[model samples]
Every structure is written in C-alpha cells, then in structure tokens.
Target: MRSFINKKVQTIKPSGIRKFFDIASEMEDVISLGVGEPDFDTPWHIRDEGIYALQKGQTFYTSNAGLMELRKAITETLSAKYDLNYSPEKEVLVTVGGSEAIDLALRATLDPGDEVIFTEPSYVSYLPCIQLADGVPVAIPLKEENEFRLTAEELRAAITPKSKVLILSFPNNPTGAIMLKEDLEAIAEIVLEHDLMVITDEIYAELTYYDEAKHFSIAALPGMLERTVYINGFSKAYAMTGWRLGYCCGPEEIMREMIKIHQFAIMAAPTTSQYAGITALRNGDADVEAMRESYNQRRRFLMHELERIGLPCFEPFGAFYVFPNISEFGLSSEEFAMQLIQSQKVAVVPGTAFGESGEGFIRISYAYSIQELKVAFQRLELFVEELRARKQV
Candidate 1:
C-alpha cells in the first residue's frame, strides 16, 4: 500500500491545524479556537433559497461551468465591489468551494516543475495543492514587521525564470494581514515585469475593517484583469460552508482549460447550492454587514484581551484571527499550543503549522463568541503566568 501511493502525495503531512482540536474534541470543557470557521449560521435568506430549490425538486446537475445565472451573479458582485469585469459565459467557473477553485486553477495552469510563488505562513493548502498539480512551490517568508503583506521586494527576490504563478491571499488567513492599494501597485509592477500570473484569494473581502476602501482585488489593478485569477465564495461571507460553493474568474483561455478539468473531475457544483448562491450575492448585503460588524467587535476584544495577558499580538484588521507572538515563553510553537491545551483546556493552532515562517507565534480565532473568548483568555493568562514562573526558576 505504501508503494502504491504517489510519491508527491506521500510527502504531504496531515494538516497541523486539525491536530490539536482533534485531541481537544475528546476532552470536556475544552475551548478550541483552532478552526477558522465562522460562527454564524447560513444567513436565513440564503438557507431559505436552498430549501426553496429543494422544494422545487431542483436536484439535477448544472453545466460543467456551473449555473449561468450564478456565474452572472458572481460577475455582477465583483464588478460592483471591486470594479472587476468578466464574461460569465467564458471566464467564470463555479466550484464546490474556494478550495476546489484553487485546485482547478493550479491544475489548469501549471506544467510539471513550473514554480509557483506564495507567502508563508499562509493557508495550509497552497503548498500541497501546488505539489499535487506538479508545480514547484516557492514559499516566500512574510515578515511580521511588514504585517505579513507580501512585499514587491520579497516577491521579486523569489522569482526565477521557472516562476509561473503567484498566490496572494489577503485579509490573510492565520495572520489577518491586508495589502493596501499602494502595496498592491508595487507588486503589480513586479508581476508585469516578470510576466507572471496570480491567483488572488479574496474570500475575506467583505469582512475587511476599512470604512472607505473596502477590499481591493489585485485583478482590479490596471492591466491585471487578464493576468489574474480571482477566487471568492459564499462560505466566508454568507456562512455557507456546508453549502460548498465558490467561484473563480480569469482569462477565458485559462478558465476554458479549468472547465475541462472540472468537467472530467467534478462535472458541476451542487445545483441547489448554486441557486442559493444567486440569492446570497443579490440580496445578502445587510446580512453581511451585520455579520462583519459583529466580527469586528470580536476582533477588537480579542486584541485587547490578548494584550492584557501580555501576548504582544500584532493588530490584524481583516480576518477574524490574531497571531500573537509567543516566543518569549521559550517554547516551540507546537509545544506552546499543546501544553496550553493539555494544561488549560484551551486549544489554538501553532503558527508553525502554517509554515516554518510562523515559528514563535500561535493563531487564535475570534470567530467564536465573546463569552467563549473571555473564558479562554482567562485560562491562557494563567498558563502564561505559570510559564513565566518556570522561567524564573
């Protein structure tokens, strides 16, 4: 059986994010903040749409590219939000999730040994997905001092002639870092100079804390619409994770190839989910705003409480997470996370689980309730006090 496994697949490790929580699951009164899932239920209107579709007996398949109306809805949302334009007929693809869209984009665009540059500590899937697609993974270590935004210099330094695509995720997962327009403009210049392509993951777009600008997509930058693949979904914004629907837009030539792979592999996204998605995009603004406001309140509370406990976390303004520096305790990221869970009954992910660059940090999700967070922090503060006393000894 070991011999039957593909060599590339064999090299992959199990997700470090799930490891601590799986143990915590069996324990009583454990507060697990390891998973990044939103606490919100699927917005009532979206759920209603799904139920209505089922009631109408819409259980059949959509086209391989997904429902045309859903694709059109996606395009309209992108245009209204970020000034991006795409032909729903040719450039848009509906996928099972933002995750599936990511896989399809990689498979369609990468050739064997082509290099794909992405930053770490990023979402865990990027490296494994690149390898599964036979693309070389070139990981650039993003700096905490730089707030984890991928700098033009860092990107430029990593590129070689073999580089084919760059994966950018902002309002970033794990770190919650965001790139401003000026930051992206610098990166865009480097990308154009090298003739590189990008797969920008903007699943956290609507959750940004900015009042005036909102989330800015790299694809909206001048001359970038044709060179970038934009991936977004209903999961993060509308709490539609189990609905399992996401969409991608890119150059029609690339999307045509992606559709072929999706056709052979997935056929179509769930017809019911697509119907719900159309409702989500069109009429879910107020629901999203209410959710975003709640998340923002949680985010600020977590930051303040973590600081009160002396954890020294960088302020994260985008996603619902805080990556606090835990190095002074002299424990490795894994050791810190494990011992904390074992001793205090609170579980958070080791930053090193994201990549080597995440050493000396730990990711705590704020998506859980304020009551949960308050209790969890009290335990964490006690754990920190014990560590300090041990250091004195």
Candidate 2:
C-alpha cells in the first residue's frame, strides 16, 4: 500500500509554518502572529456582490478561463494600475487562488528535470509546486543584509542551461521584502540575458507601506511582457481569502497552455467569487486603502515595539509581517518558536519555515489588531527576558 503512493509526494515535507500552527491550534490562550491571513473580513460591497450573484442564480460554472467580464476587469485593472496590458480573450486565466495560478504556470512551462530558480524565504508553495511539476527546484539564498531582495548577481549565479523559469513573490511573505523598480530592472536584464521565463506573485502589491516605494511588476519592464506570467488576486488586498479567486496574465501562448491545465484540473473559478471579483476591481479601491492604512499603522507599531524589545528586524515596507533576528538566545528557529508558544502562549512562525537561510529569525504577522499586537508583544518581552536570564545562568 505504501509503495502504491507516489514516491515524489511522499518525499515532500509538510509545510513548516503549519507544523507550529497545528500545535498552537490545540492550545488555549495562544496569541497567534503566525499565519499571514488578513484580520479584516471581505469588504461589504464584495460580499454583497456575491450574495446578489447567488440570488440571481449565477451559480453555474463560468468559462474555463473565467467569465469574460471578470477577465476584462482584471486586464483593465492591471493596465490602469500597473501599465500592463493583456487581451481578455487570449492572455488571461482566472484560477482558484494565486496558489493554483502558480501550480498551473509551473505545470504548463516545466519539462521533466528543468531547473526552476527561486529565492529562499519565499512563499511555501514555490518549491513544492516546482517539484510536483517534475521540475528541479534550485534555491538561491536571499541575504538579510540585502533585505532579502533577490539580487541580479544571485540570479545569474543560479542560472544554467537547465534553468527554465524563475518563481518570484514580492512584497514577500515571511520576510515581507519588496523588490523596487530598479531592483527589478537589474533582474530583468539577467532574465533576458538567460532567456528565462518568470512567474511573479504580486498578491501583496497593495499592502506596501512606504508611499515612495510603490510596487512594480517585472512584466511591465522592457522585453519582459513576453516572458513573464503576472499573478495577482482578490485575497490579500480585498480580504477575500475564502473566495479563493486569483488571475494570471501573460503571453497568449503561455496563457493558452496554462488555461488548458486549469480547464481540465479546475474547470473554472467559482461563479459567485467571479461576480464578487468584478465588484472588487470596480469598487473596492477605497476598502483596500482603508485596510492597507490599518496594516501600516500596525506595521509601524510592531516595528517600534520589536526594536524596543531588542529584536533587530529588517524594516519591511510591504506585506503584513516582520522578520526579526532571534539568534542571540542560542536556539534553533523551530525550538525558539516551540518554546515561545509553550511558555508564553504566543505563536509566531519560525523563519526556517521559509528556508534554511531563515534559520536565525522568526516571522511575526502584524495583520492582527493593535490591541492583540500589544498583548502579544507584552508576552514576547517576558519570554525574551526569561531566555536571556536562562542564558546567563
């Protein structure tokens, strides 16, 4: 029976982030700053649209690529916001989530044993998706000194004849690192030089905190449109995680391939969510602004409190997490997270959950309310003090 299971699936490790989360779930009074889920509910207008869809009996399957209207909205939104253009009919695909878009992209592009270059401390799905697609996962370690941004030199060093695609998530999870326009320009040159394709996850683009450092897409750069798959979704920005709707736009050839996989595998995205997504793209800007502003306030407060508590963290300008150095206490990242939860009843994910490069840190999410953050930090202070005192002993 064991031999009948796909050995490749067996070889894959369960998500490290979920390891502690599962333990924390069984415990009482645990304040979780672990998962990257938004604390905000889906905006009222978006929810109303979904309800309206249901009332109108719009519960049937949409087109394999999704409703033409939703695809048009996605293309228009991308063009208006990021100067990106795609044909609604040929170049866009709606997926179950940004997660599914990633899986489809890998499956569509990767041949057996083709190497996929991706930075470490990235979203958990990347390596696994590559592996499941029968592609080789080549990890390039991102340095804390560089604020975990993938450098051109690092990318160039990772590429070889076998390299086919680069999986990038900016306004990154775990690290909350963002690649600015110039940073992307440098990487684009390398991709062009290497003739590599890219699947960029920009789901957190709307959560950027620094007004001066707005998010930019690699696909928008020169010579990149033909070689990049741009993935974004309603989940993070619109707080529609449960809706599980995301879209990808790329060259027609690539999109056509991805759509084939999505058609057979997922058939179509949810009808209600697609309707809600139309509303989201058209009328959810103000709601996004409010949520982003709230996250920014929490971000600043967490940064200040982490610094005051003597945890040196890289200032993350995007997303809703802070990755803080926790090496002074002489514990592995997993051990530190485990002990923190056991003794302090506070839960944060270990940095190693992202990659080996994250060994000296832990990711604390700031998506919680200011009051919840205050309580969590108070517990963190006491926990750190005890660790220090134990070290002295």
Candidate 3:
C-alpha cells in the first residue's frame, strides 16, 4: 500500500476546461459562453419516440452493436447526407456516445507505443484517450492563418514509421473551423501515402454556416473508405446530448474490432435512446435544418459583435463557437478568462486550455439565446472599454 498507483493513471492532468467551469460555477451573475453544448432541448418528436419506447417496455438491451433498426437508420442517414455507404450488418456500431466511440476505436486499434497524430486545439479527449491506450499522442498545431484547418504538410510532417492512426475533427471544436473538399483531398493523399488509419469525428457536420461549403467526409474520398472510421451522432444536430447515443462506421474488419470493444465494455447503448435516434434520423431533418439556421444566425451575430468590440476573431464556417484573439490585453489566455469572469461576470474558455497555439485566444460559444448573447456582448464591450481606458488593451 505504500506506493501502488499506476504511472499512467497518475500522469494525466485534470481537464483545464472543467477546472475553469468549476470556478465559473461559484461566481454570481455569470453568463456562460464556455461549454460546447447545443442550447436547444431535444426535439419533441424524438422525445416522444423515447417515451413511446419506454411505454412499450422496450428497455432491455437489444444487441451489443445496437438495434438493427437504429443501425439501418444510421446507414441511411450517412448515405443520404454524406454519400457514405456503410453496411448496417457488418460496418456500423452504435455506441454510448461519440466519446465512447472514440475510446473504443482507439482501444481496438492501438498497441502500446504506437503513435497517433492529431491536430491541436481539438476536442480535449483525443490525447488522453490515446495516452490511456498506451499510444503516443503526437499533436500538430493548426495555425490561425490557416483558419485552424489541419494542413496536409503538417500532417505529413507528423507521420513516421511508428505512426498508426490519425484523428481528424472537422466542423472543429473550440475554433469552429471546417475542412473543405480540397483540403480533405490533400490530407487523404497523405493518409494514403502513409498507409495510416484515420478516425474522423464529424459530430458538428450539420452545423456548417457557409451554405457554399458542404461537409465532406474523408471516408467518402477515393481509396479512403477502407481506411477511415467515420464517427457521428444525433447529439449536436438533434440536440440529443443527454441521449448519449452515437455510431461509428468503417470497413467491416475495423468495425468488427470496435464492436468487440464496445460489446465487452458497454454491452449496448440505451434502447430508448436508440429508438429516439432512429426517429431523429428518419423524421428530424427539418429540426436539424431549423437548428442549423438558428446557429448560423447566432454565429454571424457573435462575429459582428466581437469585431465591433475590437476583438479580432477568425470567421468560423461551422460549429457553434468563436475563437477570438485576446493578446492585445497583454495577459495570458488563462489570466484574461479569469479576469473577464471575475470583472465582467461573463464566462468563456481560455484558448490555452485547448492547446499551446490557442494562447492568444479565448473560445466563446454562440449557443445561447439572442437576448442572452446581446447582454453578454454589452457586458463584454463595457469590460473591454474599461480595460482600454486603463491602458490594458
């Protein structure tokens, strides 16, 4: 009992985002733009479907891979929206959430000391999951000049003989950047050249703001279907976060491996949630469209207000967040976020929490209501003006 802790368990740091959230919670009059969650409740029809499932006494586990009906719905949705065809029987796996899907994929594929390449300022889980799987986490920093899109050159530079996987998250988190087809083509060339497996998180695929830029999956590209694992869910699109249901589709061999991990660890996702997810895929297209339009409006409003208040932010094309440069305040990102929350009662995540490249920025989510956004902006304006008057800007 003197010293029995596992080295891997002791090495992981607490999540920086959660630490700030805990502090922000203790503050009074705070308007949080921090969390990366959709503000909308799950659409009524989907909720009704879940309730109906419960009433029908369908609470038992269906199968480890999830209900065949839900998998079929997922396959259809993927084909209709992303032009990706995954066989429902052999190539799709329903998971507890995108988080669990990611964990299962990593566990299924990685061996100790294998290297996994991922971009910086990404969703926080990638590195930790890789480390927990005893894989090396190689982070490639995405530049602000490139709109935080991972470049082919950067990816190629990161790959080596030990590299086993690449994790790509687009309609990205924290920065709200999206990769276009050309950009994806360039990346696909590198992946093919290196013969590396890819796990792409497209959770925000439907939240794209620019009508001209459609979301394209790497798996949909030539020669990539066999090498890429596509992960997505109903959480962001249908505002079904609490449902905790997501799915992964890939080559049958890869999917079969991931299914083993999911089966052993999770057994099956919630049956009622699977029912609601089927409804979301089958009949909730209008709900997704409405939410996307609303988020686009909020995205534009936040960008305009942030720029008007003299914060220089990269214009985001997808997702529900804005990453604004805050370096002029002459404070580290953490300092600025803490000061802003303490002085202005507005909560935003420090960019440094995402990665080192995010040091001069802070991420503010645009998922709040219009009125709340306006109020938050007003407070931000006042706070900035006060800082500038005291020569802080």
lDDT of each: 0.93, 0.93, 0.91
Model 3: lDDT of residue 231: 93
Better of 1 and 3 by TM-score: 1
- State residue 48's C-alpha deviation in candidate 1, in Å: 0.9
lDDT preference between candidates 1 and 3, better one: 1
| TM-score per candidate, chains pooled | 0.99, 0.99, 0.98
Q: Which 10 successive residues of model 1 have the least lDDT summed?
A: 209-218
Write one digit per residue (lDDT tens) for candidate 3, span 244-326.
99999999998899888887778999999999999999999999999999999998999889889999998999889999998
Candidate 1's TM-score reads 0.99
lDDT of candidate 1? Answer: 0.93
Candidate 1 backbone collisions, by pair? none
lDDT of 2 by residue, 150-226 (tens): 99989988999999999889999989999999999999999999899999999999999877867899999999999
Q: Flag regions of model 3 displaced more than 4 Å.
A: none
RMSD of each: 0.8, 0.8, 1.3
Error in Å for residue 39 of model 3: 1.2
